[model samples]
Target chain A: MDARSPKRGRRRHGRFDVLWFLGVPILLIVAVEIVPMLGVVWISLTDYNPLEPDSWLSFVGGENYSRMLGDDLFWQSLLNTSYFALLYLPIAIFGAMVAAILLNQQLRGRLVFRGIFFMPVVVSWVVGSTMIMWFLDPSSGLPSMISESLGFGRLPQLLQDESTAMPTVAFVAIWKYFGYNTVIYLAGLQAIDSALDEAAKVDGASALRRFWHITLPGLRPVTAVVVMLNMIQAMRIFDPMMIMTNGGPNNSTTSTVLYVYRMAWDNLQFGYGSAITAVLSVIIFAIAGLQFWFFNRRSVER
Target chain B: MSVEAKHVQTPSRGAAGEGRLGKVVTYGLLSVGALVILGPFLWMVRSVVTPNEVLYSDSGGGIIPRQFTLDHIKDAFTAGVQPFDVYFVNSLIVTVIAVVSNVIFCGLAGFALARIEFVGRRAVTVVIVLMLAIPIESRIIPLYILASRSGLSNSYFGIALPLLVTSMGIFLMRQYVMTIPRELDEAAKVDGCSSWRLYWKIIFPICRPVIAAIAIFTFITAWNDYMWPLVIIQSQDMQTLPVAVGNMAVVKDQLRWGTLLAFSLLSVTPVLVFYLFLQRQFMAGITSGAVKG
Candidate 1:
């Protein structure tokens, strides 16, 4: 009451302002986000498809979820997503850390270097992934053309092959997204105390020792953030996979979200799609929650 | 804080400070990284202008174009199977609507959260944060149903609806507004300005930095978004740029690549131009995230 006593005039108009401001965004969020989310849960329990009115559109009680157990593509997509995560998580995190460390060294024209490095982050995924695909197209693309001209045989298809497709698309995504991670890491590096490094140098500590002790520990908080962001993004690797590989070459690069997209959009299997999405929501929720919980526990100890 | 402040003031720590060998190593590594980062865009540019015969021939992959032509660029606009012009206009319309909606809606919500002591404010903030956790993938099924049931499917409004405002935009704006001195709000009150007038005259101008940042983020995201547009616009005539490009990418053809690359480059040119103009603001917004987190 005491805190509220100083501003009675504004308080009279506060009701109208609240209705104007908070009401609109909250309603929009509910309509688009919150409602659709709950709708997914509701729709997942049925055998509903808007396209097929003749098909019984009634509650089937987890039939869609049960069906997923036998669905090879769903499982395969998860496996593919896991394979991608294995490549994406470490490379994206470590690549970004190294780039951030390099860019943070107070180097000349680091801004220019940073700007150049960050260019792909600004590019649309449809364009960026497609560009890489063009450069690597086995028959007519650069590597094969140049190789054949120099008396070498044709280069193998990186994208159209089962073995290399996932990794190649992973590389494309890493190239596009690493800059975002690097920028975050750069900020984390700036927040670290330079005085600690200077003191370590004065005490005859090696640069390696200074970095290992001070810099690495200083980056712990940001490391968790980058890891969490990449983990979630890696699982939902839709754009690059869809644009570059389309889960082709024996479905090597099909990601979970891409699978959801195909099932929901292409096949018009909204119920089954909602079931997949519900499952996906749980997995992502668990991953993010677990990481934050683990990181927070460690952070508390630190 | 002081070290970071020093960094902002003078962003360098130096080449001369290190020995010649260190300088050589750093510059060499930095240059390599930059080239690697830019290599894809360079390939796109080279292939976009090169004549198709040379581009597809044994000598196709050369860094320099063997023969130059403007026909491919013309084809990207006037000659492609998909109407690149329609895609361009649709994409522009969608992006403009999103940027405006996000700015106005999120800005109002952010202002209320930061400056007004409304009821359930804490609960609302927590809910907004929670909303960020719900992935777009998870919402796709019912989002589709919602679009069609609302009779907006195959329309621009349907494609841009889900993204008109986002939790991140609201959160970012709120954080920025919270940093602005509340004294301005109090002074505006003393001058008998209404709450909307206060926001317009005092808060809105002060919030320009964050406004620009959010608008740029919104523009880039709305411009690049492929999935929603893919689902919403069923008809080819109404398809956005990314959808058209996505379709082009799926076709397993070797001959039409010049057209493909040209369209892709054309789709990305506006973003590059916008970014170059606001590069400072763009990068600042990126760094702001990690610092706050």
Candidate 2:
């Protein structure tokens, strides 16, 4: 019995060692990510407010979701987020593609130019937003100064004005990410065989013709990645809008994530906030799934 | 003869050279693009050094500032609700702890997934990838509740906990660990090394590059993180640099442009400098992470 028990204990020790390696991370992911996700789902069904310590566990089913259905501000914010994404996706994709092609050339100082372009990606979003705020400030901003010198009047306050705030924010978002996309596309570009371009040239094809027929098609996979990532990222736009406009000038720039922040923290409406979060999460997942399926199918067909 | 020479030059230029004019155009376009990209940062640096009054003056808005002063830098460090030093320190503490936790926990987790034979390893990897799809912002509400419920809110641990074991870090480490030879493990085991010792002595030391990548990425993400920190940390004293700078902008009655610029500069300098030195590794980390994902 003593020998048998010792062997059994050794077996148990081996199992325990495996758990020791995997346990902490699994527990962390459960505690931090998965559990919170489930909690968010549960919280959406309740009207519990943390500020009121006594009523922390109260439940009200479907009311927050129903309220969100009737909330114009909620819809407006969602639309604003979509608008920002639509504006950003095309510019980011096209600009990154073009810039990547340019930088991929065998120019004398291309590396220096690549570094200069990629500077904004390394800068923090908060800092970039602040810099944008200052640079577009009507009183003494560079844009305003340039406009005045060029015989144009003082430029409009882009951030404060409702008509331009979202687009302005979108532009800054594009600028911040353009370099990152450029680098990714450059990676894609470099992977393409130079022989393909050479063959097209041998066929008496012009540079534009070669680019249109050969280069663009070769970039399909990378383009799919860039587009999917950009769309998902743009949909979750929060930091720039939160920092720059605070969803202001008539709620023009209030992204859905920012609205979630406002609902939960600013107003202490945890139920409503989680309701929006639940819905937004589903929508984001759906979009990502659709992109994945589309990309996967295309690649499979190719 | 001249016509034939011109014809030959034209075809060769079209094939390879793109000509002097083409070179001129390419350089011009690249220069303009660079200017657009770096223009705001230059303006930011100018505002940091330029006096506030001059920054506001119509004629004083140029790439180069005429008057220079350190008053704004001084004010940035000294003149806030909680001074900038406190914010810097808070950010430093949170980021340091986060980096350490990520390296250790993710290193262990990654080694197991890559090398150890265990049940549910596949399930764990699948879970990690799935978690990557869940945006942190969507989970922030419940995370905040969890932190508050556990009495972790407003503490350094609370700020760093959610970020301690990022899925990307685990995935990165696993990929790096998988590239290390299996023979090393066998060699270590032959010398009386246990699994834990194999991981610690053999695996960990060889993973300096991946560890460096994880450390840099985590440091930058933690330092620049605004939303989660804003939600979790409510105290004036516990605020990180981004949160502090954001609050300073909103709460302060007078927007001190120079001071704000200086503060922005201070917040960005560390990561920017780190990025410059380790640019290749940073880019490799990003690209490799994306490709693997």
Candidate 3:
């Protein structure tokens, strides 16, 4: 199979490789992603709702976008998303930074600590959410029992209560996420020159002074990235809110993504859902653009 | 001059003394922070083993379950809590297929992009980069429709196929492949190795670390995904771990907190075990290899 086989074998192999490697991926991407996205855009321009079969027969331009602006639920979702972002961004960034700094030091058993912290991040959110739900259960949960025992007298069930739902979701989201950010921060911290710390020490700086003046400033780019990424992620919150609250006793935990899902799937308002998604995409684009802008500005100044 | 040198050395010695105090504070803060991060996991283990009666007991100084029993574990295994077995199996199947498919395809695509200079290559690279910003939600509904139309809606292929070829996978693999020296390709070519043979025999082995990283990331992402499966699959028998666990936890009418907790504990063990073992690689994978452009 050596001499005469070379010509046939080479052609066959080349053909097979091209088909198997290049052709299949291109086909899969086109079939699954590109095609669907085009369909979504097409439907977004039409006044289509799965719930109303007749609406599919007609096309309307920008009407759905206009309706979305006046929709109260859309406004509520936007507000809810902003609030979620506000709560999640700072806690995740600062908590991760502090944890990363602590872990980055030559401490004992840092790997074990890192694993324990990051365990939740890799675990399915369903598991984490369910576990946290039990932890917060009013009647049978540990938190309520502790509260009652401590004479706080029956703490409200978090997921069921309007005021507590969104914040509680945020808390859990932070818990599940900070480990990833911490790891990123740890990576960033390692890149910093230790000579800066030594220089600060030689200048008679205190621990806090060194941290604020040198370490924090050194961590600015990472901080910017962490904050921006966290903000975007937090705004896209849905799974926990849906599982824990079902959009709540009163739409308290109705994040924008959740709202979009309900609109597109449950309410069957495809056009409206698409409009909301478009707005969200634009906003996210703007935020990320601003982050890049700030990053460039800082780099230039430095 | 000798007196001045002595004074300079004294301040350096004093700063060294301060460093020890700073070290103590740093370690103390870490210990407390570590406790906060790990506390919930400990509590979860306790809850899983604790009997319902103990869980619901009114008199409680600490919430740790007394007389730890295997009752919760027993019930979760026996009872049909949101079809636990089915969902677990479904998750395993999807994750395995997704990982294998993603790794091979991504590696091939990555190889082509990194080494080959062919027509349409630049366009392909640009498209992959731009699409990274687009989340699954943007294409989800349309994909759902396509899946339904194709009669693949509830099938594992339906859910796993789209995930198999992510832009992130391509991005990661491209970064990894670029780091391999071009000299190896030239050496292989001189040995009468074709381009595909060069990558397969020479390059793939050297890229094991990055490939392992990609595999772990893909596995975890597929295993943990909930929303898509929740939407597409209708059959309870086809439900994945996250979907099933979520359904159990959210059963509003008869919310069995104990059963829910038990199921949740069981479902996450596999993922946690995998993560605990490969965490360093996982961290490296996430942080490294940002696409330039």
Off by over 4 Å in 1: A1-13, A52-57, A145-152, B1-18, B286-293
The global C-alpha lDDT for each of the candidates, from Candidate 1 onward, is 0.81, 0.82, 0.74
Clashes of each: 0, 0, 0
Docking class of 2: acceptable
**Any residue pairs clashing in model 1, and if so which?**
none
> What are the RMSD figures for all models against the true structure?
3.0, 5.3, 5.5
- Clashes (candidate 2): 0
Better of 1 and 2 by lDDT: 2
- How good is the docking of model 3, as DockQ? 0.36
Q: Which candidate has the highest lDDT of all?
A: 2
Ranking by lDDT: 2, 1, 3
Error in Å for residue A130 of model 3: 1.1
Query: Fraction of true contacts kept, per model?
Result: 0.67, 0.51, 0.44
Sort all candidates by TM-score, best to worst: 1, 2, 3
Please list all clashing residue pairs in model 3, or write none if there are none.
Answer: none
Complex DockQ, candidate 1: 0.58
DockQ scores for all the models shown?
0.58, 0.41, 0.36
Candidate 2 lDDT for residue B273:
90
**What is the per-residue lDDT of model 3 for residues B1-293, given as tens digits with 9 covering 90 to 100?**
25654565532221212467856766676677666666666677887777667666665325654567777777776777445677778999999989998888888887777767657888988777767656677677667766866788789987786788777777777877888877566556556787677778877888898788778878888888988988888788888888888887778534355667777778878877766777787777655532122
Q: Report the Cα lDDT for candidate 2.
A: 0.82
